[model samples]
Target: MTVTPPPSRSAGRVATAVERASSALGRLRRGRLLHPAGRSFVGETVIWGTPGPPSGVALLDQPGRYRTTVRLSKGTPTPGSWPDVLGLALRLHHDDGRPFDLLVSSSGAAPGLRNLPLPRRRFTGTYSTITCYRAGRRRLWLAVLADPDSVDLGRSLATAVAATRTDTPRLVLAVASAVGPWRLVGQVSLGAQLSAEEDAALAFDPVRNLPPELRVAGPLAWLRDQTYRGSRRARGATAQSGGSTATTV
Candidate 1:
């Protein structure tokens, strides 16, 4: 079957991100997401992931409805190189008048939502990308989004990241679903402009924040990375032994 590959994200990353975002949203909702009215947040968590082919390391999860791809390619393609695989798990839930749900949450960041820094400004209504350097082991030189005159992008992002208590996250959810209609209740919506009160409240949400124990890349993530590296080493060994295996994501 020919996969359309929505948003350039490969299969693996999409599932992981969606799962994380969904779970986090669920925990935070507490029956608060669904409202009595028809209006709702532009985007919110709705469905969890469905299973896919049982591949190595649970990378390619298939919800059938979602479009996923691999983020990291085999070789170091480019500096700002968006991986062949990424995480694309969003649906255009609403498009009545305004395009509000520009970015939504995913599931893998569960219990923790994937957030992209929104430019705080009186925007002229133009989409723009910002080049920034992340200071961490990954030290990723990635693109961020912001407004023309929004100088507080960094601070806002820092506050949000600090609110969630997570390290620099690579993928920010651009769209997602909610348990019910958040707009109806006039409650918190995933894509709504967060107020200071809402930010403060979410900063401490048990589900929104990751436990200190799971703070850093846990053993599983480490294992996945190490195992990936080890596989490369093993491949090298095989190459030396005059045997070969073609790796594919």
Candidate 2:
């Protein structure tokens, strides 16, 4: 995959404006810009040995397994009964002491309306991403596979306990590692449920934290960091205020 050049001056200006607006919006909400409240889970990921041919990217070239943590939530400050974006954030701890984080939102449930503001069907099961990234000359994406019914409980504090099941949740990342076929990598299993406080402290900044091999070079890449900065600033401000970083589910 050819690397797209960085954003131009005009695009930079627009990104800056969006970031500022996002920060303002977060302050107004007095919480995270998105997925402010969520249930946490500890799990693990296991990459298949024959995942695919060598991808050139070191992370995906070899098969491996690791521990992971996940946060499941509705993208908006609403109840699960409502139609809204579903969210899944993951943190994978590799054996080499590398921690990779991923954040994904559910797509529209209907065909041709994937871009619509529809909630992801069956919040508890699977999550995939159409967004592609450049790894050297290769392009890739990621996915997290799970049983949507793994925890069918509602989005309430009481129901959050259901996520801490005896079975550990695993992270399944789908990456188009090589030119051949899209393969899954970085599978990690989740363990326990994190307390509200612990969840609040965990942050996923893709641009800042993504591994160098997973180089971001698509047309929309420039906007990723800018868009997230607003939320990061807002979250920081909320924490400093000693306010509830997340709304009570």
Best by TM-score: 2
Give the Cα lDDT of each candidate: 0.21, 0.58
lDDT of 1 by residue, 136-189 (tens): 232111111222332221222223223223322222221112221111101111
lDDT (tens digit, per residue) of candidate 2 on 1-249: 123435565766777788899899978987677788676766565656436466566655666655556677777647645656777776655445446667666753223332234464355444544355666676655555554434453444335455455444344565543233435565545456766776776666655456557755555555666667788787784211221122111
- Model 2 spans with C-alpha error above 4 angstroms: 1-7, 94-98, 108-118, 147-160, 177-182, 237-249
- Deviation from native of the Cα of residue 118 in model 1, angstroms: 19
RMSD of 1: 21.6
lDDT of 2 at 207: 56
Per-model clash counts, in order, read 40, 17
